[model samples]
Target: MKCISWNVNGIRAVLKKDFVEILYALDADIFCIQETKAQPDQIEVDCELYPYQYINSAQKKGYSGTMIFCKEEPLSIRYGMNMEEHDTEGRVITLEYPEYYVVTVYTPNSGDGLKRLDYRMEWDKAFSAYLKSLDKPVMACGDFNVANEEIDIKNPKTNHKNAGFTDEERNSFKENLLAYFVDTYRSLYPEKVEYSWWSYRFKAREKNAGWRIDYWLVSPELKDKIVDAKILTDIYGSDHCPVQLDIEV
Candidate 1:
């Protein structure tokens, strides 16, 4: 089955930009999105095929949030990491399918110049622990907000001091990938120079100056099942492209 993930940036905003058309084109078995920034009541998507709709929207308006639109119904669903503070921002939505679990996240951005770096580090710890606790194989996918390595970004040396490429942030992000499971994109095509998010500044998309901050992380148990992984770099909307994976059990 195909499991897809994207940071839509804003549900309300992307609709005008052909969000549904993109979703239909993907035609994934399960569709997950981050940075929706809106509640279900606040928006509407017309899709008869994928009847299951789940969302974890921030209590605050026009802020961080996530959602999963799936064709297959999950046996169970959960929101947040069981932490009150973390739930407020609506960052995580866990769907327990019969075969595997899917955790979609909109990991907090550390802000320019590492302004919110401390808070982001705390989130990393909490979020990583939450994923490990599941133990059940998971497809933890969405906007991770930190480019994993030098290959994941265009100009690594110049970006070292930047928010998404800083030593501290990169280390924090790197540690979790090591502890948890496999990074699907990096595993399947290690040599591919790809990116999932681009900056709005300086025609980053045009120059192809980007970061592989978004991901599709699979549990170690499912490592062998990952058939294909891709960053939909050619697709566009919200300055972030969709990352997709096809898994064969």
Candidate 2:
């Protein structure tokens, strides 16, 4: 199956762009989206291909949210980590199939001056535990927010202390998620440099100064089934481009 994940930044805004067209062109079996920034009632995706659509919207209007569009119906669907504090943001959505569970998350960013770093660390721990509790293997994807290694970001030296590239976040990501999951893109292309997210400031995209924050992480057991993993840098609509994972589940 071909699964694609993208942080659209804002669903309503991206809809005005070429979101529908791009969505059709990609033609993924399961398309996961993050940072929807809209309520369930406000999200109207005009695509007919995906009959089974699920959205997890935040309690607060126009904030962090996630959505999944699937061509095939899942056996079950779950929203959030089931933790009250973490569930409020609509950051996580899990779709359980016969073979495996697919989860998409919009991990909270450490705000200016790392104000939310403590909360982010707590979230990482809780979210990792949630994944471990799943009965089957998992294919988790979305804007993870943290750049795992120096090669994952363009200016690692300058960004080491920044939100996504901070030492604390990186170590937590490695210990929590990477301990059990395989980062498909990095696993396949260790030396190839590419990025999925670019800062809107300073013509970052134009200059190709970006970070590979978005990812498709699968359980270690599913690593061999990975056909291909790609960062669709050509696609435009959001600050973060879509990351694709073609795997046999």
Candidate 3:
């Protein structure tokens, strides 16, 4: 199956920028998006290509949210981490298939000056624990918000202490992998230095100064099933590009 995950930044905005055109070009079996910033009722998406749709929008209007469009109907769908503190943000959505689970998340950013670092750490631990508790093969993808290693981000030396590259956040990511998941992209291309999200300032995308903050992490057991992992840097609707995973389901 071909699964693609992207942080569209804002669904309503992307719709005006040939989002549907890009969607048709990719033709993925499942399309997962983060940072939707709109409730389903508030917007209209002609996602007729995909019969099944699931959305989790934040309680606050025009905020963090996630949506999943799939050709395959899942056996069940779940929202959030089953924790009130985490669920309120509408950051997570899980779809259970007969073979595995597909989860999309919009992980909270640490914010400028690392203001929310503490909360981010708490979220990482809780979210990772929740994934582990699934006890089934999982494909978790979204804007993870943390660059796992130096190679995953440009200007790593200067950005080490930055929100997304902080030591605390990186370690939380590592700890999660140590438990039950594998960063599918890194597993396939350990030395690659590509990125998924780029800053909109200073011509970052033009200069190719970006960070591979988005990811497709699969349970260890699904590692061998991975056929390809990719970062679609060419597609442009949002500052964040899409990441894809092709696995034998």
Report the poorest 10 consecutive residues by lDDT, candidate 2. Answer: 40-49
TM-score-sorted candidate list, best first: 2, 3, 1
State every prediction's TM-score relative to the real structure. Answer: 0.97, 0.99, 0.98
Better of 2 and 3 by TM-score: 2
- Which of 1 and 3 is the better model by lDDT? 3
- Give the per-residue lDDT digits (tens) of candidate 2, residues 128-216: 99999999999999999999999999999999889999999999999999999999999999999999999999999999999999999
lDDT of 3 by residue, 18-88 (tens): 99888888999999999999987976778677888899999999999999999989999999999998898
lDDT tens digits by residue: candidate 1, 187-238: 8888899888888999999999989998899888899999999888888778
- Report the alpha-carbon TM-score of model 2 versus the true structure: 0.99
User: Highest TM-score: which candidate?
Assistant: 2
| Among all candidates shown, the one with the greatest lDDT | 2
Model 2 ranges off by over 4 Å:
none
Candidate-wise lDDT, in order: 0.88, 0.96, 0.92
Runs off by more than 4 Å, candidate 1: none
lDDT score at residue 225, model 3, on the 0-100 scale: 96
